[model samples]
Target: MRFALVGTGLMAQEHIRNLALMPGNIVAALVDPEPASLAWARRSLAESFGPATAEIPDFADVPSMLAAVEADAVIVASPNFTHHDVLLLLLATDLHILCEKPLCATIADAEDVVARSGGRRGIFWVGMEYRFMPPVTRFIEDVHAGQVGTLHRLALHEHRFPFLPKVGDWNRFNRNTGGTMVEKCCHFFDLMRAIVRAEPVSVFCSGAADVNHRDERYDGQVPDIIDNSFTIVDFDNGVRAMLDLCMFAEGSEEQESLVAIGDRAKLEVGIPSGIKTLSPRVPLGAPKAVTREHVAVGDDVLAAGHHHGATYFQLRAFLDAAEGRAPVQVAARDGLIAVAMGAAAEISAREKRVVGMREIRA
Candidate 1:
């Protein structure tokens, strides 16, 4: 499949690498407003794919690229704020889309896209690649298989270094990236919804910009994004999920830890490393037998980079869906809900109150 990839930043580089590895997929066009990013993309593509890269075209913007390129699909990896416009333009064409998460910076924009996109012929796939992460996929499968019977609670924790600087530092502000939760935690939110198989009804969040990027100024503007947050989500199905995020922690064996508790069993999984554990049947009596099992993901998906090897599988699924061989695993509604969760969490944290998901939904 020929693809016009929007944005040539770090994430785009990963997509470029993965696209190159695919047998018939080719990046036909690169789109970005910044000359430096476009130039970097050209060099990176040339370095990665050698002389064949010359056949690919680079554009200063999406509209011009869309006009010039004939592609089977477009991958929208542009900044969060630009997703709405970029996607609207691409939706006019007959190309499938694999859009990055947080479909739009705001729920209003998301609603606009959803409304305008009604009955569109293209396969609009949201890029919630965490759903394809090997360990995460396995964990969800196990939960659905009744390994963790009747899940009641889930906790997802992330302890990592501060946000990595983006191509233009656009991610440092909520206006551009839709807050830290939307920018970073959307993956976890999407995961929570997927694993629990329920819609979040309300969120209570506590967050502060206590560290990371506070002392730094970009274009004379101090970053306002919160570096840490704890969010509690109440799902419609009576499942509860909590997210704990810390951007100041250092030297961790794993970047994320997830625990799911059910009526009959409990499950724990660590990110990147893909170490998983399951404890079946807590002792109700002193003589009751209980068992614990540890499972390690055998594949080294992380070696390929980008979300611990899930990108490849995600792209493959997109390709399969586009080819009519499979259904889209991550739908546009999934992306909207993830964004709503984040936006509501941001509001809840800022206002020191619980925010309903309906408050963000247009």
Candidate 2:
């Protein structure tokens, strides 16, 4: 399968690298507004992939780029705000799209994308790499197989160490980038939906901008979106979920962990790692010392590098799904759900009240 990477950013470079590793995928073309960045990416990709079958060409825009490149798929790795425009142009083609998370900037665009691309020949795969992790996959399997019995409640805490980009900075501020909810924590929300096996009923959120929003980090012009947020989601099937996202956690390695309690067994899936079973041995009056077993993932996702091995897994899965070898792990439908939750969280924060998912219209 041929791929036209829409943006030449860091994520795009990671996609190119993963594509190079895949058997039947190639970076046919590169697209970006910045000429210098595009040129650099093309040269870097060519060198990394060895002598390419065709010359690498860069395009300034998507329409012109698609017109010139004979690619079967396009990886829309552009900024979060530009997703709507980029996907709008590419959805017309038969080309499959692997868009980065938070499908679009708003719920309206996400709904529109879903409606427009409903019966199309190509598939829209969101780059929610966390879903592709082995632990997450196993957890989903266990839940489906009745291993965990009836699900009750789950809690997720996603903490990211401060590592915002300095150049062309919209990521640090939430105004243009859609804040931490859309820009960063969409992965956890998507995972919650997947594990819970139910749609979100209502959501209530509370947040503050206590991290990296100082005068030194703020560019003076950008608005301060909350860097820390806590959200509670009520699921349809009587399952309650709590999600906490923090961008200012010190001494944390962008850590994310999920604890799902069920009637049979409690599950714990550590990000960048595999599943661990926590036996239900309630502590006694004397404080019971409880310890059973812990199993780590065999795959060296961390050693594979780049955002805890998600970039590689997500890229490979997108290619595999396109080639009819495997299913798309994080489909556009999942993307829409995630974006809906994020959008609802934003609304809940603004209104200072519970926001129903059904009320969150396009």
Candidate 3:
């Protein structure tokens, strides 16, 4: 299938590299208003695939690309604020759309997309790379397969460096990127929902822009995005999930740590480490039955993109869905709920109160 990328930014460049690994998909046209980003993408495509890929058509915007080129699918890696409008045009056509996470920068816009995209011929998938991570994928599978029998609690931690610089520093502002919770943590929120297999009921988050971006100023305005926070989500199935996020901890070895505790045993996994540990219940005086193993991903796959080659895995599944071989794993509704959960976390952080999922939906 041929693919057209709407925004030629860092994420789009990652998609280009991952597509090179796939070998079946062709990037027909690249679209971006920023000349620098477009030029960078051309170089990246050539470097990722070959010199021939640099000859792909380029356009300043989606409409111009749509008018000049034909593509089987389109991936929206544009800025957070532009997703709604870009999707509005793409959804009108029959193009299979793979929209990057945080569906929209606002709940209202996400709701509109969910409402409008009731039934479409082409596939509509929300890009969620976390669920496709190999070690995390194995962890989730073990948890679901009764390794962590009767699961009740889950803890997810992401201690990593601050957000990378975007094209125009758009990520520093909440108004443009839907706050840190929605913009960045939406991936975690979606992961929680997928693993818990239930809708979120309430969220209580304590967060602040306490560390990063303190001295940085864009037009004399300090960045309001969160650098550290703790968000607790209460799922309808009585499962309690917590997210511990620290954007200022670049020295941390593992960027992500996930733990699931249940009645029979406990499961733990760490990203980049790619190690999964399982400890079954043991009597007070019995020997520990802890087991450790690694889920290996090829070096070539790992080199494709970040998230431990998740983009490549996700793209393969997405193409399968596009070709009528499987259902859309992450639908618009899932993306909307994930956005709502993130919004709830943001509101809870600012208001110093628990925000109900119903409140956001209502």
Candidate 4:
């Protein structure tokens, strides 16, 4: 399958590398306003493309790319703020779309995309690749299979370094990147929804731009994106989920961890470690029955990108669905919900109060 990559920046380069790992998939066209970004993409493309495939066409905009290239699908890896506009150009066509997360930076735009993409002939999948991580995937499966029987609580923690520099430093601000919560934590919210098997009811988040980028200024503007946060979400299914995010913990052993507890068992998973643990309920002072197993992901797969091979797995699954082999796993509605949940968190953090999901929906 041939794919046109819109916005040839960091995530787009990741997509290129992951797609290059696929057997017959090729990145046919590149679209971005920044020539430097386009050049970065070209360098990455050189890693796999041969002589005949050397001269991949590049475009300054999506329209020109659409006019020049014939592709099986398009991957929209553009900056967060450009999603709604970029999608407007592509939504007019029948090509399958794999839009990167948050759906949109705001609820209104997300709802618009979901409504417009509903009845299209081609599949519309969002890039919620966290769902495809090997350990997380196993964790989710185990939770759903009753390992964490009658689920009640979930806690997801991400302790990592600060956001990387982006093209034009577009990611350092709330307006451009959806205030870190919608931009970064949408994945967690989406994962929370998936594990809880329900929509969120209310969100309360206490966060601030506590660290990272404090000494930096772009065009005389201080970065306002939050660097650390703890958000609690109440789900309709009676599950309570919390996200503990800290962007300054570069030395942390596990970059991410997830815990789910229920009446019957407790399940936990850690990334990088790829360790999954299950501990069922036991009577007090009795022998504990617990299991800890490492979920193995191939070294080459892990080398493809930072997502722990999720991009490659998600792309392959997307290819399968595009070729009529499977159904779209993450739809536009899922993206919308995730974005809404993030918006709720952002609002709650900013206002110092709980934000109801209905308020966001309305």
Candidate 5:
């Protein structure tokens, strides 16, 4: 399948690398506004893929690329704030799309994109790659297989260093990247939605720009994005999720940890490692069972360079769905919900109150 890639930044580079790994899939066109970035992408592609990359075309804008290229689909890896406009433009072409997370910067934009993309022939897949990670996928499977029956609560915690500097530092501002929660936590939010198997009804969040990137200034403007946040999401089916994020905590043994507690069992999955399970005994005075399972994610996936080997799987799944070889896994609604959850969390934190999903949707 022929594809057109939007943006030529770091994320786009990762997508390009994965695209190179896919058989018969070619990047027909590259779209970027900056000439220097486009040239750099061309050089980078040639360096990475050798002579075959020479045949790829470059365009300054999406319209020209859409008008000239005969691509089977488009991969939208552009900036977060530009997602709405880029997606709307791409949807008009009736080609399948694989967009990066936080589908849009705000709820209204997400709603608009979701509305417009509906009933279209193209498959709209979002880059919520965490769901495809080997360990994560296995954990979810175990949950559905009754290992964890009727999940009551789930907590996703991230203790990592401050945000990496982007190509343009657009991520440091809320107006550009839709705040830190939407920009960084959408992956976890999407996973929470899938694990709980329900819609998020309300959210209560508390966060602040306590540290990291505070002393930095761009164009005389200090970064306004929060460095730490604690969010609580109440699902409609009585399942609750909590997200604890601390960007200032660096050099942690595990970058992320997820814990799910249900009536049947309690499971803990450590990022970049394996899963641990503990189940209560049914009979009175019976001993509980403990188990630990390690996961081998494969070196090929690791080389793909995003989300610990999930990006390759995500792209492969997207290509298969686009070609009608497989069902679409992550729909536009899923992406919208993730973005909405982030937006609602931001609102909740700002207002110091519980924000209902209805308010976000409205």
Candidate 6:
């Protein structure tokens, strides 16, 4: 499939690298606001594949490029703020879309995408890559298989070291980025929903930017956004989940881990390494482990890739759907629900009350 990628930041380069390495796909052209980023993309393509690839300065002006390239799909890696507009624009074309997570900055825009996308022949997939992780996929399967018996509770911890975007970049500010929860933790919320396979009945959360605000990293100019949060979610099946996120942790490895409990057994998934289990369903008291092997650790799929190799799987899935080989992996509705959960967490933190899921949808 021919691809046109928008945005040329770290994640974009990672995607280009993976796409270059993968078979049956080619990055026909790249569009970015940054000349350097575009140059880097071209160079990266040259280094990996060859210099035969063409490059463009901006996707905003890609009508001619689109006409010339005949791209089968467009990958939107722009910041959270521009996601909706770019997506809406791309949707106007016949090109299928594979966009970064959160879908849009607000629920209204999310609904716009949903409303306009109805009955479209092309597939629109949000990049909620965790759903593609082997460990996460297996964990969900084990739970549903009764290996973990009746689901009980879940706990998720996600930490990153002060994700301050480029100062001039729109995403560095809260209003533009859709808050930390929506911009970053939406993946986790989506994962939680998928793992539980139940609707989120309600959510209560508490958080603040207390730590990052004081850190010198912000240059005394912190965005009006919470950098840390503790949220409790109620699932329709009587399952409860506690999620903690801290963006100020100083660690070489991005901290991400999940613990799921059930009547029969338990599962713990550690990102970047593998998954470890302590299942009573096993013959002995010992636990087994499952690792992500298809893609190398720290490969674009894990670090910059978003939830292991989800980026690759997501891209492939989008291509498949675009080519009528499969169905949408993550639909617009799922994207909205994930965004609503993240937004509700922020509202819960501010209002000092349980922000019900209904309020989010409403």
lDDT of 4: 0.91
Top lDDT prediction, candidate number: 3
Q: For candidate 1, lDDT tens digit of each residue in 298-358?
A: 3434555557777877998999999999998888878888888999989999999999887
Q: Locate the minimum summed-lDDT window of 10 residues in model 4.
A: 46-55
lDDT of each model, Cα atoms only? 0.85, 0.76, 0.92, 0.91, 0.86, 0.76
Query: Model 2, range 151-205, lDDT digits (tens) per residue?
Result: 8988988776764673366576665566677777788888888888788999999
Residue 18, model 5: Cα distance from true site in angstroms: 1.3
- Structural similarity to truth (TM-score) of each candidate: 0.95, 0.90, 0.99, 0.98, 0.95, 0.88
- Candidate RMSDs in order: 1.9, 2.8, 0.8, 0.9, 1.7, 3.6
Q: Model 4 compared with the native: what TM-score?
A: 0.98
TM-score of candidate 3 versus the correct structure, residues matched by position? 0.99
Candidate 2 Cα errors over 4 Å, as ranges: 51-54, 217-219, 273-275, 281-305
Measured with C-alpha atoms, the lDDT of residue 168 in candidate 2 is: 68
Q: Which order, best to worst by TM-score?
A: 3, 4, 5, 1, 2, 6
lDDT measured at residue 149 in model 2 versus the true structure, 0 to 100: 68
- Report the number of clashing residue pairs per model: 0, 0, 0, 0, 0, 1
When summed lDDT is taken over every stretch of 10 residues in candidate 5, the lowest stretch is 273-282
In model 6, the clashing pairs are 301-308
Q: What is the lDDT of candidate 5?
A: 0.86
How high is the lDDT of residue 24 in model 4? 85
Tens-place lDDT digits, model 5, residues 1-362: 88788998878888777777777877789999987777777876786677788888889789999888898888888899999989878888789899998899988898898898888898999899888877888888888777877789999999999989877888999999889889899998999998988999999999989989878989999999989999999999999999999998888877788888898778888777655455643667777577888866778668867577788888888888988999999988888899989988888889999999897686
Evaluate residue 120 in candidate 3 and report its C-alpha lDDT on the 0 to 100 scale.
82
Q: What shift in Å separates residue 145 of candidate 3 from its native position after superposition?
A: 0.5
